[model samples]
Target chain A: MTTTNGLPPTGKSARIELVCPAGNLPSLRAAVDNGADSVYIGLRDNTNARNFGGLNFELPAARDGLDYAHRSGTKVLLAINTYPQPATWQRWTRAVDTAAGLGFDAVIIADAGLMRYAVRTHPQLRIHLSVQGSATSYEAINFYHRHFNVRRAVLPRVLSLAQVEQVIRNTPVEIEVFGFGSLCVMVEGRCALSSYVTGESPNMTGACSPAKAVRWEQKASGLEARLNGVLIDRYGANENAAYPTLCKGRFKAGDDVYYAIEEPASLNALELLPELDRIGVAAVKIEGRQRSPAYVAAVTRVWRQALDACAQGTAAPQPRWSEELRRMSEGQSHTLGAYHRPWK
Target chain B: MKLALGPLLYYWPRQSVVRFYEEIARSSVDIVYLGEVICSRRHELRLSDWLDLAAALEAAGKEVVLSTQALTESESDLRTLRRIAGNGRFPVEANDMGAVNVLAGAAPFIAGPHLNVYNPHTLSVLAGLGVRRWVMPVEMPRHVLEDMQHARPAGVETEVLAFGRLPLAFSARCFTARRNNLPKDDCRFSCIDHPDGLPLDTLEGAPFLVLNGIQTQSAHVHCLIADLDDLAGLGVDAVRISPQSRHTADVIALFRQRMIGALDAAAAARELEQLAPGATCDGYWRALPGMTPPGNAP
Candidate 1:
């Protein structure tokens, strides 16, 4: 059978699906209209990975979004990606029950225990391992598959394209890689820097650089946005300052201060579409459910054009929309990240 | 309660690692987890040496558990993980789920702290898959553990990270190697220079974090000596004292003394602070910011 992204069943030039993040209904529609083959969203609770204010979907909104995506022949994946506490597993269980009841395609999960529960309680529900789970190797992916019968895995961003290719070749599971958005320096599902400073962990609470912990203060030097009482960046009066995630902060390393973990930039690997498709990546994920609908539309449109070009055995098309995307990026900068080994 | 000395989080000389465990064999610790848990580039102690050390510790009447690297970035990492999981000797502590899968149903194992077992259902699932004991995630509070314990399967014992600098996060990029202007692949075992992790100070020169290769830890060493009563009350089966460069054995002794009521909380806390490589904080166990002192508990 042909995969959703329109690649033939040969598996040689595997069809690459464009998976976009939809924090709200507007973004969901934008993604579907612009060419996202599938969209992933989470409920407006701790059950979802993007547990931020003014983001994510309420139950009604989520059900409506799923219905819309389904009508358009686009798949919708529900992310119940946070690790549940002993007293709070029911909240997650209910989320799984809701997703299955609502006729969503799959639930993206991070916790092994929760994965087992989801596979057992909702045996018909397809499972995709969340990138937050930090499955970095064939062994980890195989473990999830053997135990929870996970159908796919959203590979961690740290892996190179070659590594991704190796993982895809070795396992029966479909491999998903981040094609764009904020490059997390730390492993996604396992990081606790935000929680260490703000009493909320990404793994346990499903948030990082959480909105509540962020505060913008005006100083003599410029504007400063701090996260968890630490000044992440101090921009001059005319210079633009990005929202300070801990990793994307300017810090002193010995005598000089620079963006030690990462420059305040997002990943826009538009140039690597053909390579990713050639390497047999089943799907490409765009990070940032916290982004605006316009941002989702622009990114989805550019990637859609590129994917269509790659499918036709043409030179991969470049969407000359970098200026539009720059406005939406963290600090108007971008990188290919570990995919090209630029950092190395 | 049986004590398990967690893997030496820092990179030291191979001889230092051997000597540390040799000394640990004589201490109050019942189990010892040996191997490189931080960056796999640290080859001061090869797998053969780690296996040899595990045998020595086991012969000394302590249970031994070999630990795999927390961040596995290469095929070599997987090969090492497979070897440790298939060693067929002492149990392996599956730090990452990769190791857990390798050890799953092959033999019983210890789920390390990095596995993030925060709830009971997960605990039950792990117990079913041959995990005999599991270490609680560092930031989980006492009450959460109590709730989990109430639902935990009968045979699985619970362990807490009782003492040492709290491991806050691990990354693919090595901060310690980066600081020394080295690539992670060619880190040259730079983390060995910082016996305790390399202290990272804020712009104002306030100590904030400690860099241990790929692992970032709290600069404030976590001391739960004052919480022995609380730990006992929670029915915690073991208190894991992570090894530091200085006075680790003495710190273990202080916990032993406090556990048996030979010392009060005040005395134990004071001794722990004095023996600490830096300032002491138990904020993780208290569910507060990791750097906050007990006096500032919210």
Candidate 2:
């Protein structure tokens, strides 16, 4: 069968693994019960990238979620993805130990030191390189695999479909691509726009446009979204306001005021399943670990159905799937993200 | 401390690019990094042209290091990267791990700031892969850098971005082209028009970011000319001054004079503020918001 990018099938699994996000126990259950092959979670600290308030798993809830996911035959991966401060380095190392002690399937990590610690200490714990690790090329993926024995890598949302296929074709490590969620216009982990405005960043603080730094002020002109008191965007009365991510917010370039970097659109790659499956992608990851359980269930359900349908020879994404996903998308719309070269 | 010129980030006209290096050869800078670190679509100076310039700069008594693209996206980009990695004459500064992978064990190289070497262990890991020196990620705070300097392995040297607008982020989408309302593939090289990057401002007319093709930079210049003494105390070996469209030579002179104690730190800083395109900030050095000037944040 002909593929989208013209690469012949590698005779891999017809049904790819569907990895889902779980911020808390209910979200974990939502992902697990809704047919996620694997579920990823973060600890309730700055060690992981999704350290939002009222989100992620605390110790007790983590144990319960681990038990539930294991009982449901779904693997649980703990994300220890943020870079550790030199003063607080041990906290991140301890997090890896916590994940291993909890009987977690694997540890998704970004810092090389933590990876070294995991490799030396746990020895048997599978290491999946976080997208925050920024291993965009096959050689880079192979570097982590060679040094730390990293088994799987979630690619940063920068590569085109052909580039993703090139990486998968070249590396022995399992490849995971973002299937659906809010789009990060910049390369993951490499961006510092948030920290540039606010002192906190996803790399250092595990939060981008951290909730505490965000302030909303209603003015006669419009509602202004500010991060650390810097005006990110001002919305009109009838306009749909997106979260004030430094990239997605509107700004002025020359004479025109627009979303100069990127518009507020979520990534929905349901149509690219056949190409992803054809290219031998081991897993398709959904991007919101800080999202609600309902969002998790809704996105996971659509992707799960779509993946299954693709296995059964569905060529295009169903209209209903796109409609359902668009409702849950940020800005009430979705784009194919960097998968399509033109989107770049 | 030695003064190093960072890779020219903007897509200058070929004559302007060549002339910039010719001026650099006579400048007070000790090291010169050549080649594209931003978009691959910029073809005014190809790999051969960079090597020729590197050789010319080397002959002119400056230490030369070749820099790879910060984000490697296409097969053509990879081919250019492979050639840069394999360029036996010069040590390559690895901007991505892909470059690190290709250059590792082949020869010792410089780990560019974009590689995200946050802690000593990550530093040691790259050091193990033959990194001779590492440029600190620009947003890294002072305390973290002090800790890294203390714990750095014996052979590795540390460098900091001492001047120029901070490269805040990189995207697959060409923001410059997007601003011009052109597709990336047919961008018509719009970045050439803005030698200092297309300025992006907030709705209230506050300078926010500068868009240069696929890379975004802080609109405020990050000036640490006054902090050279502090950097020396922290064991920093060198400081990089990114090339701006105008007054780079004067900026280099000010830094050189400060290094030799001929120019007072405060005087040099005041002089640098005049030379920079926009207002100056050293907040990243002080570990505050990157745009905050020291003692100026509300």
Candidate 3:
């Protein structure tokens, strides 16, 4: 099942867009300055999935990014992707209104209610169904497209490249897929592992393994990281530390105790750029809004050149390109993730 | 409130599954949801076999609704879903949007717990698409359900997960298979061993979660036998008791008795704790962290 794209020729001319993430104002600028064709951002509240400490844009900062991205010829997509609580729906609706008022190019959303709000309130507002929404098939994606008039849908990380091309051939909607950054083992919106431990999640509260529930202490044997009093990991002296997320942590399962769900790693899909373009993928996304601006700059710059190479008919530069990205990955490692079935 | 038996989350032997439903058919359960909602590979019962079982249950005067998979990534999963949706005997529960696409604008189908229905607008939209009822995700708080109920669409029913180990999450990677060092595609149906689920503990030996193939469930069963009055007060239409390995019928009878004023909340709580697989918690209903039992201060 190689990438023999069955989708009608995407004109052999449509330049695939490079979408990047922004955690804060600086990161937003870093994405724009580093050749990102479009930048996705989240507001400074639970309305967005990346609501972490001292991160995300407040109203004024969002206004600035909106202006800056438009002036720089880079599109801005606001990620109000979290499911708003019943009492909290008003805030989410207001967030959509704010996005429309600020002239954001699109609003990435997961919750159906929020999509309804955005659609009814500002019908012209372009909507991109977030991967957090968990629409994994063309049937699912088409449901959203027909009902809500969604312009594009971000593919969940669970699909292989063959499955992706199969979906593209079936649906009229534009497809955006994750290219690089921290990987979620579970389907995005459907997961509640974070809230099950920390009372926070990307779906319900827009936070995952929040820092407040995180505690790190150096013991005699190793450094221990715990989330809400549950020990996630213990690292021996000289062992590099990784963030304590329930999915990434080591645990006792059957006779073997290991990183039972997934290891601390990031997803880098630069190697598949040409194949992704041939499959008619409209955009390739970078997935870290909880990262530093330097991290954003390093990843965005590398992917930008790789994407341009497909147009130049040049092979993507070798070991150096991968080594530079490895330095930015979680645990300094990268996998093509679900794109290649062996990672599963 | 109405009582529903959610689709069994475990992969029991075919005989066990058939016998379980045979007992449920004679029990007090009003709605019986049947299907392979967790992993598509669990083949003890095929879709036709499920429909055959559905016929037996429905013949015994029970409402039947077949449920789709929680994670429908493959084309085969969708094919099975289309068959279930087009079963034409009873309503179908749309667990994923693929199921929704097939069931929409035809017959009224259920919006299963995996669908995110936290707000009134999403509820209204689903109602328009012919959702007769929607299950509350296990982690939703009571107040959120109440708010949605206040503005719920007409003819729409609200169902809350009342009992059993709460399914916290699902993934493409199978933890149960991985625990045995088996690749996902080549997994040897290891989930059938643990009829309840494989319990995962922390380093200090505190039970945290249960691994059931690709699904992760709560270590403690979410017992809402004591919260019946609160549920009634909030106008909740149905309370679903997920199928566990043991004492499920007694759990159903207890809810039936409590609903008919035969039992009080305190006594029901005591009896339910003894029947549950582990400790009982209702922290999600109280809006605290899900692990903490309700009424305990955070």
Candidate 4:
């Protein structure tokens, strides 16, 4: 059926794909039921993007998820995004080998050295450049494509639509842009602030704002969480507080205290589907593999419907769904950040 | 070991940029990287101006390397990279892969810290592509660099960002421009106002990070004055000193004295602390958390 926007039904006729995250079995089911043309997941351990507690899939679980998605005519992309440390390249190398041997549709990667290794060893495996690579320009994107034969690039969150269009115009690789998720204020893959405070490199370790160092303490004025002995943020009793990731923390500029880089908000760019499609983005990515199954279902359902409507050229009137998203978000707020000029 | 004065990561006046190099020509620094690294918009020194400065430094018996911008946002940026790569007079420090592609096999070049050359294999690849020197990524521990050095291709000189506020990350969204409520394209060169960098403090007024346009740097200047022996043990060829706003030339002199045993480690460490803009940290060298200053050097 066509959406009010006159877009074709999501799976039936759209050129663009709706890519969703599946951290586990239930999230996998939620993503498929909600309307993901494809779901990306990682094997539990340091091999995946969401290398946190209570998330990710085991090998058997990943195998089941892959088979389930394939049976349902959906795709499964494996994320091997983190760089391999000197002593630990074998772990990442094996993850790539496993993902290739297990029939993943594509394996997303961020490390240049690992990309070279994958291209040389697993020549037939499809490689998608991870956003963590921070390939923001046409030249950067083309460099990866020419060198590694990358089939797609998950564009960094920092690009404007105009820049995205320029990149697509100049490069042959398919483009994937973030559609829903907690937006990173800092450029992904390149940031070392978290590693500075804590010792884990997000690029090498697949963790940022690592939980091992996060300490939530209740004080008389409010609640404070220290990330590596530095007080990242504080929230009053009535205020909703998110996990104090380094870039999202409150800071003082001069006399003013504000979220210097970002406030706690999830990026909901569902309304920009038509703009994204017009820019020739080959796929739309939803960014919460560590979130709950319910979260995955709700977000995936909304965007799947939105993408379907956009394809039919009759996207629904902008839904007043901020309240619904706020309930799903970390700080009870959401934004369309950098995608539109929201900074003024 | 020799010292290379890294590119000025801060915005200094045109005169200050020239004067800093002029001082460096007579100073103990053996190599000087001259160019704008933090933001391409901070154009106090254009290509011609930088080349002129490079020529002056070269004339005064110093090796010069032109550094490419760590973050390239436009076609104009690629043009700049191409120009620097083809300059023919001096080596180029390939900060990003775009520059790497342009410089690969053309000539021997220095791979700057941001290229993320974490291991021997990556170094081997770049070495094959003609990287004559590779700067250690800012936070790599001493042991990791030692391991990589052992397996490094011969003639691949290793340089470490031994001093400076470590450049943590670079972005297309300019934080310094955003602080002024300006779009990156119309930044109006606001980063120039803060000659060192715009210091970002925690809500409680703790110094955290310094914002330099698109680049984010550490609040604490990374000082390896006390760890020179360890670095030399790793066979590091050169220690890169990033230029700060004040007392940079003095800091270079102190580093030279310490490296040559003219000053003891304790005296050098004390001098470094006195000269720093803020607290000093060398945890990256020790493999502890980068913000933690190790109590004693190994």
Candidate 5:
């Protein structure tokens, strides 16, 4: 399955790009100052997946952020990843036009029709397939590359290390894997769990488990978390409470009640830097465009150091790096996610 | 107004699967989607076995479709998908884009619900690739579908999920195996014991989701027999009813009766509630939480 398309000849020769998230102007600055090679941001509209309130860049802020990132030698990528409805398809195309016109480094897209528009109307804009595209296999990635001229494809956090290497070996498109962030148990773009509970989903609305649908009531039984009146989880008086993302909530399966789908943990693949670099992955992405600037700075700083150490062949588990990332991670814990087989 | 049976999402024993389809051969379903859409490891029925059943269903005047898996990771999985794409006998239901790529110009196919077609532009693109019909994603509300139906490409048909548990999500990790405390590689085919999938409930013991191998489905069945007139008004071509371990024939017959105006929607809904494995909900149809009752929505 090996192809000699874009593989780095040696591990040391590859310079794995560190891609960070920016939801606001300060976060964009934090990523750039902390040594991000590229910063991806979404617009204020629901055109992108992280359509949270008071987050994302308006037109003026986006222009400022783009100027700042480019001035600091950091590439700015526009994320117009959500599927555009019939009446609003023009909005998505306009977003692509805006990004290309404003000189954003690249535009990450998911929908096939939008990809066609990007390729046809703005052919020179470098296209990156967002994880929302759900192209888990190299064949799928190759389909997008062949049809849309996508330069890079962010692999979903579902493949094992060996499977990812297989995809990297097969496709000429650059592979980007998630390096650190809050984990999604379900495959991106394909999951309907949130919509089933709240009618808004990442595919249609660019939001999952929307805050408006969430209700945290101090019931007599315990601290109850409900999504649109359906019970998601309940914590005892002494137990710590976490945000009620549908997948991370505890549920009763078979003989016991527990976190049946997934635990409240973040994915930290800092330890896999050497392997990712060796695998010819063009980028390692940090997921969370809705966090504080401090969270962005801390994560970008740690990942930058780790990727550098791996390139110098001095990479090893450092207590300080792990401690810092743990503090910023969801639930103060992390897993290797699907990059490790046992996690599956 | 047409009824199509969705592909079975569970791994049943060989005899039960054969017996179930043998009965479906004589049922009133117009189209039958046949194959493994959940986990590739569920080898109770391989491609040949599915083809045999497809032939049997076709012999009884049913349109048969071979469905590909939702998550294709292994090289062997791709090989299976390629074979299905090239089957040539039956129309294929593509669950992922890889399947769509292989089947693009070869022949026409049906877009499975997992393909995530939320907009008319995406539907038109798939229609250009020879998609004759596109299944609506289960969680899409009626308003969105109305807009898509208005602008959908000519000759492209729309199908809605009418009955059975709504498949909410798919993951690489097998929750069924995880429930049994086993790794996915050596899952021991544990899903065979539960023909309808193992139910997962909230801590307070309310039915929530069903864990069927790698796929998670709503514990409540998504019945739209009451919305038959609305679907027809919107020009929907077909309605799909997912298979269950018990009472699938009765469920299909009820929907058929209601579709023909022989049975009232209220009476059909009442009967279906009794026959369904769990309570019924249509919140997603009304643009609210899926678990919300149809009457509770604004």
Candidate 6:
């Protein structure tokens, strides 16, 4: 094992949960075999936010993963985060029942009705408000806490460090902030650009940049990427063509044709872990349910070492940590992303 | 079956905004959503001015709803929201859960589009919390709406963004200010320059998006005048006509005529398209890509 269970805080600051993503059985083992305090996975169906085919877990796999994590004395959080359509509302409620029945640690949810049902039906089961719920303020976080008795709330990636601290200072619920992964740029649960082009979105369909609509072409001029029928980006000679997610697309805003909203970069908050610890962020989440086991192994290893050293009062963001993180990032790059005021 | 004026998405001069609502007070729209829903810094109209206009619209035989900011961050923003919800005048529209916190159980409010109320169970919970009406999220298709209507909580009216450029996304980074090479704190009100929002085109020279402060809307207007009968069948209580700088009065009248059966879908779409900013698309209503307009099939 490259890391410990990560349940007890090793740093001088409070115990901060290192919540990691587990898209499949191997990724879940990579996280548990390394050092995730808790690992969150989704169902294979569209009931979960990461509804990509050939990814995520089936009922048997989910039950198995829960058994593996619980036996290792690690927590397993099930993500039933996508907003269910009226016709499919029963599926979400049933997922909640399944998660509770499986004796999972907590169910991370986004829909209001789902939370209400979870709290009413499974009163003993803990609820962590999913980031897809997009609660950025203390009042909003408190609303969930007051009504549904949510034990934790994942703050959206839009707030700055100072704003995050302010939100923590005012709310009673445990706060979980994004530690690493692809940035949504736009507010999650609100973006429609993917659906506008691909007719699928995280809020409705539980998928962003659905695979069916993506097309790549090597034309005479450059490498071009298109979503549905709309051309998202074109690359020049010797340039790396990053995956065409809607927010990261290069488009024309005014006179300058550039990354209009956000550049093609991943968010790495490794440097801010110290500050986040001082601010009392109860957990740090890593995004990527669609990533492979190798990707998870590399990221989870670095984060585990750093977080452990920080808990032991020996934390130094070693040079190798950033270098490793950079190699695995989108476009081989990363940013603080709205944590610094200039980015906002 | 009914017409409601949505909150204006773009920032305009104070006089122009006042005049736009002054005309709206006498228009065919039955309900009017007021206030700056995009940017908290767009102080062209103060809270008092919005309240006064709400009073004026109520006097003109219209129901008034106060709309809150889509993204509430700063302390001042929350302070403004608490005041708006507790203002004791009209039903407040909770755009975000921050607004819902202030209005929960104390006053009845409309669950604005930003609330992300997609399924019936969420609607049922909000109805329990005193949400009298809720605007369906913009990107939802007709079948989703039909499903929601089937399991909808009792007595809560549903509104849809039946007209105008669909608001695709909102961000903390103000794209309008970013386009002008300015920081958000020192934006200097550049969003006022484009009353209908600054347009963005694709590299292929195709019209793409509209940048209004922190919001990105579709370049082409989204018209559902062609689907009024379908909305009625789906039990949509109100059809929202989002405010545009030009010919919004005409948009309202056209929608109103269709709502009352004074005009058929074919004639209504033709008249409505004449007043649209660019072209019109209703693909999302038909469960297709939002930018793809359902062709003239009716």
Residues A7-95, candidate 2: write the lDDT tens digits: 57666556689999999999999999999999999988999998888888889999999999999999999999999878999999999
Give per-residue CA lDDT, model 3, range A1-344, as digits (tens).
33354345644235889999998889989999999999999888888888877888988999898888888999999998888877767898888999999899999999887887788889999999999899999999999998889989999898988888778878888999999899998888888888877777778888888889999999886898999988998898878899898889888865567887899999988888878888788999999988899999999999888888876767566677898999999988888888998776
Count of backbone clashes, every candidate in sequence: 2, 0, 0, 9, 0, 4
Error of 1 at B219 (Å): 1.4
Residue ranges of candidate 4 with Cα displaced over 4 Å: A1-14, A320-323, A341-344, B181-186, B296-298
DockQ per candidate: 0.59, 0.84, 0.77, 0.53, 0.76, 0.76
Q: Rank the candidates by DockQ, best first.
A: 2, 3, 6, 5, 1, 4
Which is the winner by lDDT between candidate 2 and candidate 4? Answer: 2
- In model 6, the clashing pairs are A10-A311, A10-A312, A11-A310, A11-A311
lDDT of each: 0.82, 0.91, 0.87, 0.83, 0.91, 0.88
In candidate 1, what are the lDDT values of residues A105-181, reduced to their tens digit?
Answer: 99999888888888988899999999988889888899899989999999887787777777877889998999888
lDDT of 5 by residue, A1-344 (tens): 33343554433238899999999999999999999999999999999999999999999999999889999889999999998887788999999999999999999999999999999998899999999999999888998888889999998889998889888878889999999999998999889899888878999899998999889999888999998777889989998899999999999986698889999999999888878877778899999999999999999999999988887888895889999999999998899989999888
- Candidate 4 DockQ, CA atoms: 0.53
Query: Between which residue pairs do clashes occur in model 2?
Result: none
Screening candidate 4 with a backbone cut-off below 3 angstroms (N, C-alpha, C), the clashing residue pairs are A5-A313, A5-A314, A5-A315, A6-A312, A6-A314, A7-A311, A7-A312, A7-A313, A8-A312
lDDT of 4 by residue, A137-180 (tens): 77777778888899999987876676677677788889998988
Give me the TM-scores of chain B across the candidates. Answer: 0.97, 0.99, 0.98, 0.97, 0.99, 0.98
**Fraction of native contacts (fnat) of each candidate:** 0.51, 0.80, 0.77, 0.46, 0.73, 0.82
Q: How high is each candidate's TM-score?
A: 0.95, 0.98, 0.97, 0.94, 0.97, 0.96
Identify the CAPRI category of the predicted complex in candidate 3: medium
Question: Ten-residue segment with the worst summed lDDT in candidate 5 chain B?
Answer: B289-298
> Comparing to the true complex, what docking class would candidate 2 get?
high
Candidate 5 — which residues are off by over 4 angstroms? A1-13
User: Candidate 5 on B22-140: residue-level lDDT in tens?
Assistant: 99998999999999999988898889999999999999999999999999898888999999898878999999988888888789999999998988878888898899999998888
Off by over 4 Å in 3: A1-14
Residue-level lDDT tens digits of model 6 in A1-344: 11132333322237778899999999999988888889999988887889998999888998889888888888999999998877777899999999999898999999988999999999999999998898989999999999999999998888988788778878878899999999988888778988888888998889998878889999987988988868888999989898888777778866679787888899999998877887778999999989999888889999999998888877679999999999999888899988988887
Worst 10 residues of 4 chain A by lDDT: A5-14
TM-score of 4: 0.94
Q: Which pairs clash in model 3?
A: none
